[model samples]
Target: MSNPASATGTAAKAGLTMGALGVVFGDIGTSPLYALRECLQALPADERSASILGALSLVFWALLFEVTFKYLGFVMRADNRGEGGIFALLALSHGEHQRPRKGGSWLIILILFGAALLYGDGVITPAISVLGAAEGLESFNPNLAQYVPLIACVILGGLFLVQYKGTKAIGRIFGPAMVVWFLVLGSLGLWHIVETPAVLAAVNPVHGFRLLAEHPTNAAAILGAVVLVITGAEALYADMGHFGRKYIARAWYFGAFPGLVLNYFGQGAWALSHPGDPTSPFFALVPEGPARLVLTGLSIVAAIIASQAMISGTFSLTRQAIQLGYFPRLQVNYTNPDQSGQIYLPLVNGALALGSIWTVITFKSSNNLAAAYGIAVTGTMVVTTIAFYSVMRRRWRWPLLGAAALAAVFLLFDGALFYSNLHKLVHGGWFPVLVALGMLAIMHTWKKGKEEIFRRIYANEITEDELCNVAASDRIVRVRGTAVFMAGLARGTPLVLLHHVKANKVLHETVVLLSVVTEEVPAVPDAERVEVREIGQGLGVWRVVARYGYMESPDVTALMERVRDTGVPVKLTETTYYFNREMIITGGDTRLWHWQKRLYSLLSRNARPVRDYYRLPPMQIIEVGLPIQL
Candidate 1:
């Protein structure tokens, strides 16, 4: 008889594996729409057959080494309490309690740059995926060629438009649809492979080596295009937390890997047979009939699904960044209550929509967009490799020799791909670099600006003892009801609290100094969520620190209830919240450039109010304006 607990766990793992196929593999699964075509286009006209085989061999080996071996084998193990991504990796490597040792700051910059590249990936993935899929219309009816961009733009717009509604309803279908998608991919490739059995010879590494040895100049360009095959590899690592490492690995081994290899080989086989027609080898595999139309429809569906995955990923990444203090707080709306991971960020969604549409218009076709794709993906791959090596040494405590040996192998592949993609810098590759640089600047400025502001504010901060002395003396009067002062510093009395007593001439009989800290992990246990203590000076003063994980929404009202439940009985209606409203006066002594000062001021003014984010009652909230120059 099957044990009930074991059966339940088995069912849960199976479900997660299926879900992973839909979200994690979407980008790579849809790559066949253009990756093979782009690779073949970069090759010389003379050695068509050998080139196709060589490219196929490269694609196979890339997946084997990069995605299968490096990410699935090594990177996934460095999870931060079941969460994975570059930021999670950064947090793990730095150690939650310890200050980063020696050159850790530089490591952080590398991780930030890597994360910035994903935004480029986010913008370009939809444009290229949808356009590549839409371009297949030409195979069915040549008249549809002119409408590809328009069709792709509309599909992309629709994809972004529906993001707010959340994917929960249709998310169930995504797993099954992707399952069917992979099966069809495998079946199509198997059919073609049976017909052209000779194409199997491409599996040999010698073919790939020979092509490079024969044409070193063209090889780099071909390598640039070949990187497309591994474009979505990072997503595999990024999305691991949504599905556990075991489940994602199960999905990759059982589903995505087989489908991708078979389909790629089948496309290569078809390319070899029809060397004259350099049109999309993916679509050409199907006869120009209803079957072709069906394939095109499937490709578009797969592309839209892939686009949705990236858009959702951007939302998650932005939320993490905001929690980590790298970005300004934007409105993060959770769409599904049952699933904590399901979130919608309006500003991120809007920006991504505009960027994707602009890309579709600027490139005009997937073929043109292909040049812009690999740079961001390869750059991110290199950064991921470096960060992973750091994690292996610092977090995992692997020996120096072992870590260095592994790093050498991973960097060898990552470095080659990165250099190959660099040739594209002049040809549309600058788009991602520009995007990454701009993002990096904003992130660094925001972080530095916040730090400088904090430094300035805390320079003359009053101590808890000083506040108690004031409370004890006749200098300040003690009023009736409870007052909560929101504080940034963990130890010092908040400026707003001190100013309130000075200006208002009185303070509530009960004063609570509340501070919420965002931790490095995804979720903090409720047992460790709130820490309360009495800072006694006979003023009924309490120092409260509420800790939240990066993934949590801080609910101060709920925290108040918890405080009340723990013997500090207080009525909600009697409590008043005090907050500091900072007005930045720039152009003083600042490390930031003049324009950055202006930008930081702009961001600070427009940031969401602390009271609102903490969900405090608006009517009961009092704001104290504090002017500071930086």
Candidate 2:
């Protein structure tokens, strides 16, 4: 018999795989509701059967190559400490090319844009998914079509409202619900497949190629619509941390992929039998009565689940961005204290809520929103493929030919999707592009402004020897207890510390100059997390450099413990934290333009206090205001 402990471990892994199914697969799983119908809309009425088969073939191969082979086979292996996404990929790629190189700026730009593009995705996915599902109500009664947008808006609002609770409470049922959703998707498709077994022939690659060759003009349009099937492709890699690579891969291969394939082929079979029917082929698979109603309800639930995943993903992305210093510090709440990833950002949530609600109200229908959708997803996919290529070459030490070959195949498909989606720009596709551009501006400004501010702040930084000399001199009096001075640079004394010593004319008996550095990876190993150095010849003046990965939230109390573990014992109760609060006056900036300075100043002024973000006790923390023009 198997060991009881081993059995429990196996069972737990299986459970995580199930949970991965619910959150990760919801977006792609629900694509069957509209992806096929939208693709068929691009086909000529005269050759409906051939077009349906070809489109189905393309969808099949796209999933096979993009999701199955490209992601699971290759890109998943480039994960950064269990976390995967554009940012994680950037960190992985940067591991080898640590120094700035010729193409480094372009690579960084692409990665930042790829991340910014997700906001566009966050807006479109919910509007389209929920709208697509609610549109199913139209199948039962055509008069219900007018209510679809309103219903979708209500659902979207409700989904955003609950994000504050995090996914902990409702996440339990996500796996089961999505499992049933996929089963129904497959069963409905299978039910139709039995009636029309010829749909299976679409699995062959020839039909897709034939469509591309025969109707090159219309193929672009069809491909644009077909790309919808893989819209949620990034979530597989994005949520790799929440569920391990193995579990996500298993969930996709065993649960999501098969179900999606069956459903798409099943829709194609149904469309072949009933050509020129304007009704949605997905709901049409179920008989027009109560069964369609049930499927519609399931579709709505699945869509909401998809929206939830995207919303939660935005929260995670915002936290990572802030931790990586690409964005200003925002208010982050951890709903589940035990789970670090289960965070909620109110600013991100409000922005997404407004954007999504505006999308629903503006588009007013899934079909309209569909026009705006694919660009961000396709752009992100292209960036991901490129980032993966960089990793294959630099980190994995793959031969140039091998890396180029891998990149060429993936980019060919990704480029085609992105090129085709460009047709949407005039017809509402501008929304995501605009959102991405706006986000890029904000991120670029914040990063540039922060760099300039740091440059100015560190220009007068005193070295360890200088600080040691001052500490040993009789010019300064030593007080009781430790004063933990937070600094931007690890070695130099913080400006705030200088200000404190100059004004108060006294220093703490035990001075801990704490510097927290965010490294490029997801999580730093505990052994490398803290580095303590004696600066004043055992005068109790020590420099502590605490390194954190981008995925981590720094807890000063914990950092103190680590410092204490290194023989520098300190009590948090007695120690006071010092921070420099920069009063940014934007008129006299060194590099930034007037508008950029104003924007950066607005962001700086509104950013959460350094003490609060670091989780220091409000009472014990003292902020020294230093006015600076930038």
Candidate 3:
């Protein structure tokens, strides 16, 4: 079942689709600014005709095979708590409890790796989107080259600047802007197609196939060409929970799909008509003078919207990643309760802003920055293919061979795109690979460290029965209210409890051992997740967990009310919450590369204040600092 708490029935169904349109479609929507033009930039005259057709064919096939078959058909079903993202889907497909019990499994390892790659994605999205949009400045005046970086910086800064205000304020503008983007793409491209009817040949698969066969080198470039069109493909599936699977499906079929096809074909027609020109056909599509200026203004707005979609996607993805334990927890704020779509993440916003500005300055033009654009998009797509197969076999219970067949078609296309982007690696693509690698390192290291800490502190050897004996014998007076103890593991004694008993030697009469478990699915039902039981005596263990949709948060107060009927009696005067505070040490027996442990420790201390995030009362909370040797 989808996440039970947030979007439900009609709201989820409609929200999912619209959310996808605003977020998922951003990368692909803005591709018209350069996808066709870039393909032509790399193709020679004899192969140009065939290249155009072949590129279009590859783009079409990539969308249908990789996007439609792999994601739309399969991975969307692998939602975690009703939320969809690479990490969330990975957590869903990977068995959390079972793997932890098994200890050191590849399933767990790869899941962490996939999550790290998303950070890579977070950095790359803004870089390319803003860079691509800023490159349009060349259309007005090639001399604008020196100023492109400045313009890109300004636009990116503005994007990050408005994050605190939340998307609802700006989101209204996104839909309308994208609508304008589509109209501009369609009308402008149609004008060129009207002039050169022969351009229609590119729509045929044979032309695309022939072009690739004729010039293997040029065909290799089609991988990058397809990259342009499918750049935003991940957003489609990542945002599945936001819009629901159906809404994204419709927006693609209706709004985004038609506009992209018409415009790309239109670019082909223009190229065919003006074979001698080296400048981009997209600029040529606009009527010169004030009209061109107006179109440019509109394109700029569309670019911002595209960036916004990706930016919001980053925040949403980070939330899922944090909730799923791929990254250290950061502060997550909800701007709109009714529209679960509105969220603000301060760290993520700041990071994206800095990265985007650095990219714009370093490349100085979209053409140069465009060189680095495709790898992460296509890499994530390839990773999704593998994850998609897992979903098919494990989640969907699809037969192995059928899943393989479908995945093969999709991965081959995705592989082509990835290989295609390799050509740009030196040009600018190295940046994303660097970003992805750095992110992967940080994620793996932190997970390794945390897990090591979990292993060390949790001597599962000490049974709860033993703790119960110790707790009962201790001469601690019974408090009228319940004191909640949040534990990392269910049955194993929490280090906090042991440490508290050792240091304080007192137990609350109503000692509730609470643990919050986030399942793989996007949403968990209250009946299934929230449980309160009597573990006996003044020491009753309350296993309380609040499930977050890909959109919701892990708020403690909200959950307390949800599970009130559970055996743990609640009284504000009697209730006191406890969370463990970790103190880091440099030297320890850890599998982590030393640097990662250091980074993880630094990150943990600074993450969002847990008490405030959960909306727990200040006086009613206790944090115990448990020191660990890394």
Candidate of highest TM-score: 1
Q: Write one digit per residue (lDDT tens) for candidate 3, span 1-630.
A: 333245568765555555456667877888878777777876777656545666666666666665677677777767664567776656555444434322256665665555556566666666666666666667677888678778878878888898888888787666656766787788777787788877776666776677677778676665676677777777877776655676778778777777777788788787776777777777777755777667677777777877788778778777766665656777777887776556888888898788777877787766676677887777777777787677667767788899899888777777877887888888878887887777666666666777888888875546767876776674754546677777876666677777777777777766767676665556665467576665645655545544554445666776776656564577656688887888898788778767877888887788776687667888899899888888
Of models 1 and 3, which has the larger lDDT?
1
lDDT of 1 at 340: 70
TM-score of each: 0.97, 0.96, 0.90
Q: Regarding TM-score, does 2 or 3 come out ahead?
A: 2
TM-score, cand. 3: 0.90
lDDT of 2 by residue, 176-207 (tens): 99999989988888989999999999988999
Q: On a 0 to 100 scale, what is the lDDT of residue 88 in model 3?
A: 66
User: How far out, in Å, is residue 65 in model 1?
Assistant: 0.6
Residue 104 local lDDT, model 3? 53
Give per-candidate clash totals: 0, 1, 20
CA displacement after TM-score superposition, residue 511 of candidate 3 (Å): 2.2
Local distance difference test scores for all models = 0.86, 0.87, 0.71
Model 2 ranges off by over 4 Å: 1-8, 97-104
Q: Mind giving the per-residue lDDT tens digits that candidate 1 earns over 228-311?
A: 998899988888777777778889999999999999999988887888886788998788899999999999989988989999
